[model samples]
Target: MLTGQKRKFAIALMSGSTQAAAAIKAGYSEKSARSKGSQLAKDPDVIAYMHKTRGVEESANPEVTKQKVEPEKMPVVNTLTGDFDDPLDFLKSIMNDRSEETDVRKDAAKAMLPYVHAKKGEGGKKDAKLGAAKAAHSKFSGMAPPKLVVNNKG
Candidate 1:
Protein backbone atom coordinates (compact mmCIF):
# COMPACT_ATOMS: atom_id res chain seq x y z
CA MET A 1 0.00 0.00 0.00
CA LEU A 2 3.01 2.27 0.50
CA THR A 3 5.70 3.26 -1.97
CA GLY A 4 8.66 5.64 -2.38
CA GLN A 5 9.56 7.54 0.76
CA LYS A 6 6.59 6.11 2.64
CA ARG A 7 7.80 2.55 2.18
CA LYS A 8 11.38 3.46 3.04
CA PHE A 9 10.23 5.38 6.07
CA ALA A 10 8.15 2.44 7.30
CA ILE A 11 11.08 0.09 6.84
CA ALA A 12 13.34 2.41 8.80
CA LEU A 13 10.77 2.73 11.60
CA MET A 14 10.58 -1.02 11.98
CA SER A 15 14.34 -1.03 12.42
CA GLY A 16 13.90 1.08 15.61
CA SER A 17 14.66 4.49 14.10
CA THR A 18 12.51 7.42 15.12
CA GLN A 19 10.07 8.68 12.50
CA ALA A 20 12.02 11.89 11.95
CA ALA A 21 15.24 9.95 11.44
CA ALA A 22 13.38 7.52 9.20
CA ALA A 23 12.09 10.36 7.07
CA ILE A 24 15.59 11.62 6.52
CA LYS A 25 16.77 8.08 5.78
CA ALA A 26 13.99 7.70 3.25
CA GLY A 27 15.36 10.65 1.28
CA TYR A 28 13.13 13.38 2.62
CA SER A 29 14.70 16.81 2.74
CA GLU A 30 16.40 17.60 6.01
CA LYS A 31 14.53 20.90 6.33
CA SER A 32 11.16 19.14 6.42
CA ALA A 33 12.08 15.61 7.41
CA ARG A 34 11.10 15.95 11.04
CA SER A 35 7.67 17.34 10.31
CA LYS A 36 7.16 14.98 7.41
CA GLY A 37 8.11 12.00 9.49
CA SER A 38 5.84 13.15 12.28
CA GLN A 39 2.97 13.60 9.86
CA LEU A 40 3.51 10.22 8.24
CA ALA A 41 3.72 8.45 11.57
CA LYS A 42 0.49 10.08 12.71
CA ASP A 43 -1.44 8.44 9.87
CA PRO A 44 -3.68 5.58 10.98
CA ASP A 45 -3.06 3.56 7.83
CA VAL A 46 0.67 3.88 8.27
CA ILE A 47 0.37 2.68 11.85
CA ALA A 48 -1.73 -0.30 10.83
CA TYR A 49 0.63 -1.23 8.03
CA MET A 50 3.63 -0.94 10.29
CA HIS A 51 1.98 -3.13 12.94
CA LYS A 52 1.10 -5.75 10.35
CA THR A 53 4.60 -5.81 8.90
CA ARG A 54 6.09 -5.86 12.36
CA GLY A 55 3.95 -8.85 13.26
CA VAL A 56 5.18 -10.73 10.20
CA GLU A 57 8.79 -9.82 10.97
CA GLU A 58 8.41 -10.93 14.56
CA SER A 59 6.95 -14.28 13.54
CA ALA A 60 9.58 -14.87 10.90
CA ASN A 61 12.40 -13.94 13.23
CA PRO A 62 11.16 -15.31 16.51
CA GLU A 63 14.64 -15.69 17.95
CA VAL A 64 15.48 -12.01 17.75
CA THR A 65 15.50 -10.07 21.02
CA LYS A 66 16.87 -6.67 21.89
CA GLN A 67 19.68 -6.44 24.41
CA LYS A 68 18.85 -3.68 26.93
CA VAL A 69 21.49 -3.89 29.62
CA GLU A 70 22.68 -0.93 31.67
CA PRO A 71 26.38 -0.64 32.53
CA GLU A 72 25.77 -0.93 36.26
CA LYS A 73 23.78 -4.11 35.80
CA MET A 74 26.64 -5.84 33.98
CA PRO A 75 28.33 -8.51 36.10
CA VAL A 76 31.84 -7.67 37.22
CA VAL A 77 34.26 -10.01 38.97
CA ASN A 78 37.32 -9.23 41.06
CA THR A 79 40.01 -11.34 39.38
CA LEU A 80 42.08 -11.57 42.57
CA THR A 81 39.22 -13.01 44.65
CA GLY A 82 37.45 -14.72 41.75
CA ASP A 83 34.24 -13.29 43.14
CA PHE A 84 31.66 -10.66 42.26
CA ASP A 85 32.52 -7.10 43.23
CA ASP A 86 31.42 -3.55 42.59
CA PRO A 87 33.48 -2.39 39.64
CA LEU A 88 32.90 1.25 40.63
CA ASP A 89 34.90 0.75 43.83
CA PHE A 90 37.87 -0.50 41.84
CA LEU A 91 37.61 2.43 39.43
CA LYS A 92 37.28 4.97 42.25
CA SER A 93 40.37 3.65 44.01
CA ILE A 94 42.34 3.80 40.82
CA MET A 95 41.21 7.38 40.18
CA ASN A 96 42.21 8.56 43.66
CA ASP A 97 45.67 6.95 43.71
CA ARG A 98 48.01 9.85 42.85
CA SER A 99 50.91 7.44 42.30
CA GLU A 100 49.09 5.61 39.52
CA GLU A 101 50.21 6.41 36.00
CA THR A 102 48.29 9.41 34.67
CA ASP A 103 47.00 7.51 31.64
CA VAL A 104 45.92 4.57 33.79
CA ARG A 105 44.09 6.84 36.23
CA LYS A 106 42.49 8.73 33.35
CA ASP A 107 41.28 5.45 31.87
CA ALA A 108 39.82 4.44 35.21
CA ALA A 109 38.03 7.79 35.57
CA LYS A 110 36.67 7.54 32.05
CA ALA A 111 35.41 4.06 32.82
CA MET A 112 33.76 5.37 35.95
CA LEU A 113 31.98 8.15 34.08
CA PRO A 114 28.89 6.10 33.25
CA TYR A 115 28.40 5.64 36.99
CA VAL A 116 28.71 9.37 37.61
CA HIS A 117 25.70 11.66 37.71
CA ALA A 118 25.21 14.21 34.96
CA LYS A 119 25.66 17.86 35.91
CA LYS A 120 22.12 19.25 36.46
CA GLY A 121 20.94 20.49 33.05
CA GLU A 122 22.88 17.91 31.05
CA GLY A 123 20.40 15.17 31.86
CA GLY A 124 17.48 17.40 30.92
CA LYS A 125 18.92 18.10 27.47
CA LYS A 126 19.47 14.38 26.87
CA ASP A 127 15.95 13.58 28.05
CA ALA A 128 14.50 16.23 25.74
CA LYS A 129 16.22 14.71 22.72
CA LEU A 130 15.06 11.25 23.71
CA GLY A 131 11.54 12.56 24.19
CA ALA A 132 11.41 13.95 20.67
CA ALA A 133 12.64 10.67 19.27
CA LYS A 134 10.15 8.66 21.28
CA ALA A 135 7.32 10.96 20.37
CA ALA A 136 8.05 10.43 16.70
CA HIS A 137 8.22 6.65 17.17
CA SER A 138 5.06 6.35 19.26
CA LYS A 139 3.05 8.37 16.73
CA PHE A 140 3.47 5.73 14.02
CA SER A 141 3.63 2.55 16.08
CA GLY A 142 0.61 1.16 17.85
CA MET A 143 2.69 -0.01 20.76
CA ALA A 144 3.86 1.24 24.10
CA PRO A 145 7.03 3.31 23.87
CA PRO A 146 10.13 2.23 25.77
CA LYS A 147 11.26 4.54 28.56
CA LEU A 148 14.88 5.61 28.96
CA VAL A 149 15.83 6.11 32.59
CA VAL A 150 18.91 8.27 33.13
CA ASN A 151 20.71 8.16 36.42
CA ASN A 152 23.11 11.07 36.48
CA LYS A 153 24.26 11.33 40.10
CA GLY A 154 26.27 8.61 41.78
Candidate 2:
Protein backbone atom coordinates (compact mmCIF):
# COMPACT_ATOMS: atom_id res chain seq x y z
CA MET A 1 0.00 0.00 0.00
CA LEU A 2 2.97 2.36 0.64
CA THR A 3 4.64 4.08 -2.34
CA GLY A 4 7.50 6.46 -3.16
CA GLN A 5 9.35 7.99 -0.23
CA LYS A 6 6.76 6.70 2.21
CA ARG A 7 7.81 3.14 1.34
CA LYS A 8 11.46 4.09 1.76
CA PHE A 9 10.70 5.64 5.14
CA ALA A 10 8.81 2.56 6.29
CA ILE A 11 11.59 0.18 5.24
CA ALA A 12 14.18 2.41 6.92
CA LEU A 13 12.14 2.57 10.11
CA MET A 14 11.84 -1.26 10.17
CA SER A 15 15.63 -1.44 9.81
CA GLY A 16 16.12 0.49 13.10
CA SER A 17 16.30 4.14 12.01
CA THR A 18 14.41 6.71 14.08
CA GLN A 19 11.35 8.26 12.44
CA ALA A 20 13.11 11.58 11.83
CA ALA A 21 16.20 9.89 10.35
CA ALA A 22 14.04 7.66 8.13
CA ALA A 23 12.20 10.68 6.80
CA ILE A 24 15.43 12.43 5.94
CA LYS A 25 16.84 9.33 4.29
CA ALA A 26 13.59 9.07 2.32
CA GLY A 27 14.30 12.46 0.68
CA TYR A 28 12.18 14.65 2.95
CA SER A 29 13.56 18.07 3.80
CA GLU A 30 15.47 18.08 7.08
CA LYS A 31 13.50 21.06 8.36
CA SER A 32 10.18 19.20 8.13
CA ALA A 33 11.40 15.58 8.45
CA ARG A 34 10.68 15.26 12.17
CA SER A 35 7.06 16.31 11.84
CA LYS A 36 6.56 14.46 8.55
CA GLY A 37 8.09 11.26 9.90
CA SER A 38 5.87 11.34 12.99
CA GLN A 39 2.84 11.87 10.82
CA LEU A 40 3.75 8.99 8.54
CA ALA A 41 4.45 6.65 11.43
CA LYS A 42 0.95 7.24 12.78
CA ASP A 43 -0.68 5.95 9.59
CA PRO A 44 -2.55 2.69 10.22
CA ASP A 45 -1.33 1.10 6.98
CA VAL A 46 2.28 1.96 7.74
CA ILE A 47 2.00 0.63 11.28
CA ALA A 48 0.41 -2.59 10.06
CA TYR A 49 3.11 -3.09 7.43
CA MET A 50 5.84 -2.45 9.99
CA HIS A 51 4.30 -5.01 12.38
CA LYS A 52 3.93 -7.63 9.62
CA THR A 53 7.47 -7.07 8.35
CA ARG A 54 9.03 -7.27 11.82
CA GLY A 55 6.90 -10.29 12.84
CA VAL A 56 5.51 -8.22 15.71
CA GLU A 57 1.85 -8.40 16.71
CA GLU A 58 -0.45 -5.49 15.97
CA SER A 59 -0.90 -3.59 19.22
CA ALA A 60 -2.33 -0.45 20.69
CA ASN A 61 1.17 0.96 20.81
CA PRO A 62 3.26 -0.23 17.91
CA GLU A 63 6.21 1.75 19.27
CA VAL A 64 6.41 -0.45 22.37
CA THR A 65 6.47 -3.63 20.30
CA LYS A 66 9.89 -2.86 18.82
CA GLN A 67 13.06 -4.13 20.49
CA LYS A 68 14.20 -2.41 23.68
CA VAL A 69 17.86 -1.46 24.11
CA GLU A 70 19.74 0.40 26.79
CA PRO A 71 21.20 3.80 26.02
CA GLU A 72 24.92 4.40 26.51
CA LYS A 73 26.03 5.93 29.82
CA MET A 74 27.42 9.47 29.66
CA PRO A 75 30.54 10.35 31.64
CA VAL A 76 29.82 12.17 34.88
CA VAL A 77 32.23 14.47 36.73
CA ASN A 78 31.94 14.76 40.52
CA THR A 79 32.51 18.31 41.77
CA LEU A 80 31.68 17.65 45.48
CA THR A 81 35.34 17.40 46.53
CA GLY A 82 37.05 20.66 47.55
CA ASP A 83 40.12 19.45 45.61
CA PHE A 84 38.96 21.18 42.38
CA ASP A 85 36.13 23.64 41.81
CA ASP A 86 35.75 22.95 38.10
CA PRO A 87 37.13 20.78 35.29
CA LEU A 88 39.39 23.68 34.31
CA ASP A 89 40.85 23.81 37.80
CA PHE A 90 41.65 20.09 37.68
CA LEU A 91 43.44 20.53 34.38
CA LYS A 92 45.29 23.60 35.68
CA SER A 93 46.58 21.69 38.73
CA ILE A 94 47.85 18.88 36.52
CA MET A 95 49.47 21.32 34.09
CA ASN A 96 51.39 23.19 36.81
CA ASP A 97 52.37 20.19 38.96
CA ARG A 98 55.82 18.83 38.04
CA SER A 99 55.11 15.57 39.88
CA GLU A 100 52.84 14.36 37.06
CA GLU A 101 54.37 12.56 34.05
CA THR A 102 55.90 14.96 31.52
CA ASP A 103 53.54 13.80 28.70
CA VAL A 104 50.43 14.00 30.94
CA ARG A 105 51.41 17.44 32.23
CA LYS A 106 52.13 18.66 28.68
CA ASP A 107 48.66 17.48 27.52
CA ALA A 108 47.03 19.24 30.49
CA ALA A 109 48.96 22.44 29.73
CA LYS A 110 47.92 22.25 26.05
CA ALA A 111 44.26 21.92 27.09
CA MET A 112 44.49 24.95 29.39
CA LEU A 113 46.56 27.10 27.02
CA PRO A 114 43.53 27.99 24.86
CA TYR A 115 41.71 29.80 27.70
CA VAL A 116 44.86 31.67 28.74
CA HIS A 117 45.62 32.81 25.17
CA ALA A 118 43.27 35.04 23.16
CA LYS A 119 43.43 35.76 19.44
CA LYS A 120 43.18 39.32 18.07
CA GLY A 121 39.58 40.40 17.26
CA GLU A 122 38.41 36.84 17.74
CA GLY A 123 34.85 37.77 18.73
CA GLY A 124 34.42 40.33 15.96
CA LYS A 125 32.05 39.93 13.02
CA LYS A 126 32.89 37.14 10.55
CA ASP A 127 33.10 37.28 6.73
CA ALA A 128 30.26 35.31 5.11
CA LYS A 129 32.52 34.16 2.23
CA LEU A 130 35.02 32.59 4.64
CA GLY A 131 33.07 29.30 4.81
CA ALA A 132 34.22 28.01 1.40
CA ALA A 133 37.81 29.13 2.14
CA LYS A 134 37.80 27.28 5.46
CA ALA A 135 36.44 24.08 3.87
CA ALA A 136 39.17 24.25 1.19
CA HIS A 137 41.85 24.70 3.82
CA SER A 138 40.55 21.71 5.82
CA LYS A 139 40.75 19.46 2.73
CA PHE A 140 44.52 19.82 2.66
CA SER A 141 46.83 20.12 5.66
CA GLY A 142 49.29 23.06 5.42
CA MET A 143 47.32 24.19 2.31
CA ALA A 144 48.62 27.25 0.50
CA PRO A 145 47.53 29.34 -2.49
CA PRO A 146 49.16 28.57 -5.83
CA LYS A 147 51.61 31.13 -7.26
CA LEU A 148 50.37 33.43 -10.01
CA VAL A 149 51.99 32.90 -13.39
CA VAL A 150 52.43 35.36 -16.30
CA ASN A 151 54.57 34.93 -19.41
CA ASN A 152 55.29 36.93 -22.59
CA LYS A 153 57.18 35.49 -25.55
CA GLY A 154 58.28 37.37 -28.65
Candidate 3:
Protein backbone atom coordinates (compact mmCIF):
# COMPACT_ATOMS: atom_id res chain seq x y z
CA MET A 1 0.00 0.00 0.00
CA LEU A 2 2.88 2.35 0.86
CA THR A 3 4.92 2.72 -2.38
CA GLY A 4 5.83 6.33 -3.34
CA GLN A 5 7.35 9.33 -1.52
CA LYS A 6 5.32 8.39 1.60
CA ARG A 7 7.12 5.01 1.64
CA LYS A 8 10.47 6.83 1.14
CA PHE A 9 9.60 9.25 3.93
CA ALA A 10 8.80 6.42 6.36
CA ILE A 11 12.04 4.60 5.43
CA ALA A 12 14.02 7.79 6.00
CA LEU A 13 12.27 8.39 9.34
CA MET A 14 13.10 4.83 10.50
CA SER A 15 16.78 5.47 9.62
CA GLY A 16 17.07 8.15 12.41
CA SER A 17 16.30 11.23 10.23
CA THR A 18 14.08 13.98 11.69
CA GLN A 19 10.56 14.54 10.25
CA ALA A 20 11.80 17.58 8.26
CA ALA A 21 15.04 15.94 7.05
CA ALA A 22 13.15 12.72 6.10
CA ALA A 23 10.52 14.72 4.19
CA ILE A 24 13.20 16.64 2.24
CA LYS A 25 15.09 13.39 1.47
CA ALA A 26 11.94 11.67 0.15
CA GLY A 27 11.51 14.16 -2.75
CA TYR A 28 9.08 16.45 -0.91
CA SER A 29 9.22 20.26 -1.47
CA GLU A 30 11.87 21.88 0.76
CA LYS A 31 9.59 24.84 1.63
CA SER A 32 6.85 22.55 3.08
CA ALA A 33 9.22 19.80 4.30
CA ARG A 34 8.65 20.64 7.97
CA SER A 35 4.82 20.48 7.78
CA LYS A 36 4.62 17.73 5.13
CA GLY A 37 7.06 15.52 7.02
CA SER A 38 4.81 15.69 10.12
CA GLN A 39 1.70 14.89 7.99
CA LEU A 40 3.28 11.94 6.12
CA ALA A 41 4.61 10.45 9.41
CA LYS A 42 0.99 10.25 10.72
CA ASP A 43 -0.29 8.42 7.56
CA PRO A 44 -1.79 4.95 8.33
CA ASP A 45 -0.08 3.17 5.42
CA VAL A 46 3.35 4.60 6.39
CA ILE A 47 2.84 3.48 10.01
CA ALA A 48 1.87 -0.07 8.93
CA TYR A 49 4.86 -0.46 6.60
CA MET A 50 7.30 0.85 9.27
CA HIS A 51 5.82 -1.55 11.88
CA LYS A 52 6.16 -4.54 9.45
CA THR A 53 9.78 -3.59 8.62
CA ARG A 54 10.59 -3.13 12.34
CA GLY A 55 9.21 -6.63 13.17
CA VAL A 56 11.22 -8.16 10.28
CA GLU A 57 14.40 -6.41 11.47
CA GLU A 58 13.88 -7.72 15.02
CA SER A 59 13.33 -11.29 13.68
CA ALA A 60 16.90 -11.16 12.26
CA ASN A 61 18.20 -11.54 15.92
CA PRO A 62 20.28 -8.33 16.06
CA GLU A 63 21.05 -6.60 19.39
CA VAL A 64 18.56 -3.70 19.48
CA THR A 65 19.89 -2.08 22.71
CA LYS A 66 22.56 -2.80 25.33
CA GLN A 67 22.62 -1.60 28.94
CA LYS A 68 25.99 -0.16 30.00
CA VAL A 69 27.16 -1.19 33.52
CA GLU A 70 29.21 1.35 35.51
CA PRO A 71 31.48 0.71 38.51
CA GLU A 72 30.10 1.98 41.85
CA LYS A 73 33.36 3.60 42.93
CA MET A 74 36.46 4.61 41.01
CA PRO A 75 39.97 3.72 42.35
CA VAL A 76 41.92 6.67 43.78
CA VAL A 77 45.75 6.87 43.50
CA ASN A 78 47.48 8.93 46.31
CA THR A 79 50.55 10.81 45.05
CA LEU A 80 51.88 12.01 48.43
CA THR A 81 52.94 9.38 51.01
CA GLY A 82 54.88 11.06 53.87
CA ASP A 83 57.14 12.97 51.44
CA PHE A 84 57.83 15.84 53.92
CA ASP A 85 58.92 15.43 57.61
CA ASP A 86 57.47 18.86 58.61
CA PRO A 87 54.59 21.01 57.27
CA LEU A 88 57.16 23.76 56.53
CA ASP A 89 59.06 21.24 54.32
CA PHE A 90 55.94 20.91 52.10
CA LEU A 91 55.59 24.75 51.92
CA LYS A 92 59.29 25.14 51.06
CA SER A 93 58.99 22.48 48.32
CA ILE A 94 56.03 24.35 46.78
CA MET A 95 57.86 27.70 46.99
CA ASN A 96 61.03 26.28 45.33
CA ASP A 97 59.11 24.36 42.62
CA ARG A 98 59.89 25.83 39.15
CA SER A 99 56.94 24.08 37.46
CA GLU A 100 54.37 26.03 39.57
CA GLU A 101 53.15 29.52 38.54
CA THR A 102 54.97 32.60 39.97
CA ASP A 103 51.91 33.71 42.02
CA VAL A 104 51.43 30.21 43.56
CA ARG A 105 55.12 29.97 44.58
CA LYS A 106 54.96 33.51 46.00
CA ASP A 107 51.89 32.60 48.12
CA ALA A 108 53.73 29.56 49.54
CA ALA A 109 56.76 31.82 50.31
CA LYS A 110 54.46 34.34 52.10
CA ALA A 111 52.85 31.58 54.22
CA MET A 112 56.30 30.34 55.32
CA LEU A 113 57.61 33.89 56.11
CA PRO A 114 55.64 34.20 59.43
CA TYR A 115 56.97 30.80 60.66
CA VAL A 116 60.62 31.79 59.97
CA HIS A 117 60.62 35.38 61.36
CA ALA A 118 58.64 36.47 64.48
CA LYS A 119 57.00 39.95 64.39
CA LYS A 120 58.25 42.53 66.94
CA GLY A 121 54.86 43.28 68.72
CA GLU A 122 53.44 39.72 68.39
CA GLY A 123 52.73 39.01 72.14
CA GLY A 124 50.27 41.53 73.72
CA LYS A 125 47.40 41.96 76.31
CA LYS A 126 44.89 40.89 73.56
CA ASP A 127 45.99 37.21 74.05
CA ALA A 128 45.08 37.29 77.80
CA LYS A 129 41.77 39.08 77.04
CA LEU A 130 40.93 36.46 74.38
CA GLY A 131 41.53 33.63 76.97
CA ALA A 132 39.12 35.31 79.46
CA ALA A 133 36.49 35.79 76.70
CA LYS A 134 36.79 32.06 75.77
CA ALA A 135 36.31 31.05 79.45
CA ALA A 136 33.17 33.28 79.58
CA HIS A 137 31.86 31.57 76.40
CA SER A 138 32.41 28.08 77.97
CA LYS A 139 30.25 29.31 80.91
CA PHE A 140 27.44 29.44 78.25
CA SER A 141 28.26 26.71 75.66
CA GLY A 142 24.54 25.69 75.57
CA MET A 143 22.76 26.76 72.33
CA ALA A 144 19.71 29.12 72.16
CA PRO A 145 16.37 27.41 72.95
CA PRO A 146 12.94 28.09 71.39
CA LYS A 147 10.81 30.75 73.20
CA LEU A 148 7.83 29.01 74.91
CA VAL A 149 5.96 31.85 76.72
CA VAL A 150 3.52 33.84 74.53
CA ASN A 151 2.68 37.31 75.96
CA ASN A 152 -0.63 38.00 74.20
CA LYS A 153 -2.43 40.10 76.94
CA GLY A 154 -0.72 43.53 76.90
Winning model by TM-score: 2
lDDT of 1: 0.68
Give the per-residue lDDT digits (tens) of candidate 3, residues 16-122.
Answer: 78899999999999999999998987787777656544543323333441111122221233334467888899988888876444666888999999999998768
Model 1 is weakest, by summed lDDT over 10 consecutive residues, at 65-74
Give a tens-digit lDDT track for model 1, residues 32-112: 988999998877656655554443333445344232223344334323333328888888887887644456688899988
Q: Count clashes in each candidate, considering only residues at least 3 apart in sequence or on different chains.
A: 3, 0, 0
Model 2, residue 108: displacement in angstroms? 68
lDDT of each: 0.68, 0.70, 0.71
Q: Assess candidate 3 and give its lDDT.
A: 0.71
lDDT of 2 by residue, 1-154 (tens): 4656776787778677899999999899999999999999898767765554455665678466775322222123333336766778989877777544456678898888778897655663454347556666664577468999888774
Best lDDT goes to which candidate? 3
How many backbone clashes are present in model 3? 0
Q: How close to the true structure is residue 134 of candidate 1, measured as C-alpha lDDT?
A: 75
Model 2 residue-pair collision total? 0
